[model samples]
Target: MRLRYTTLVVDDYDAAITFFVDVLGFELVEDSPATTSTTGAAKRWVVVRPPGADTGLLLARADGERQRAAVGDQFAGRVGHFLEVDDAAAEYERLVALGVEFEGPPRVEAYGTVAVFRDVAGNRWDLLSGP
Candidate 1:
């Protein structure tokens, strides 16, 4: 078996969807009906992925105060997610053009080219190019 999806908590579905789909160029894999219980707010099982990635992200909107508090702080204000791309510089430029919030300037290291950026929800992610 293989891992399928990881979750990213957000404030709203459509806003999150737009960022990943429009800004990041992720493919919309699925947006279907979902229910947490018999009596609760309606929800959607939203998932998205890169053009050719096996793993996808489950965009889970915050359902309550607890989950809402977790939004943007999922990574504890650290660069916990690394999005490996073909070219960090190119992607960086595109994201900048789209007005994506980046932590700082891209820097080259022995491991690879990497730049820190914040997702729509404020979680930090590193865009890296290397092994």
Candidate 2:
């Protein structure tokens, strides 16, 4: 079976959408009205994904203080997400030009070339290439 979407808590929906669509070159798969399953509060069902990727990200806005605090630290300050690309250096440069913040320059690892960068929500992601 294939994986579906992963929930990404964000501070704002439109801002997250802009970052994924305009900056990261992902497609907006869906952005429809929804509600919280627990409280039936109004919410949104927003999904974004890389052009040819099977798994997309569900952008869920922070609903409360606890969720809000988790928005950028979902992985507890570790590099939690990975964005694989064909050319790590090129993608790194492009993202830098687009104002994406990188922790450091690209470096080579035994497995691949990679660079860590923070997403719009401050979650660290590895811009990776190679095997």
Candidate 3:
């Protein structure tokens, strides 16, 4: 069986959509009305994925206090995601031009070129290039 979507808690749906689709060049796979399974609260089933990617991110809006608190800290302040790109330097520059926050400039690592950047939700991700 193939893996499908990974849930990403966000402060807002539209904002997250914009960040992933517009800023990060991900495609909007789906965005439709939905409801919370626990309380039947209104929500949206929003999914986005990188171009040609098999896995997609399901953007779920923070539902309550605990979830809200976990929005950007899903990984507990670590680099929880790695975004593989063909050209790390170019992608890093492009993301910076789009106002994305980077912890530092891109540096060459033993494996490849890498840079740390934060998503709109404040989750850290590594922009990596190479095998």
Q: Sort every candidate by TM-score, greatest first.
A: 3, 2, 1
TM-score of each: 0.95, 0.97, 0.97
Candidate 1 lDDT (Cα, whole model)?
0.91
Q: Candidate 1: how many backbone clashes?
A: 0
Tell me how many residue pairs clash in candidate 3.
0
**In candidate 1, how many Å is residue 52 off?**
0.7
* Native-referenced Cα lDDT, model 2: 0.96
Q: Following a full C-alpha superposition, what root-mean-square deviation does model 2 have from the true structure? A: 0.8
Cα lDDT tens digits, model 2, 13-129, are: 999999999999999999999999999999999999999999999999999899999989999999988999999999999999999999999999998999999989999999999
> Per-residue lDDT of 20-127 in model 1, one digit per residue for the tens?
999999999999988877456789999999899999999998988899999999978888678999999899999999999987777999999999999899999999
Q: Which ten residues in a row have the lowest lDDT in candidate 1?
A: 33-42
In model 3, pairs of residues that clash are none
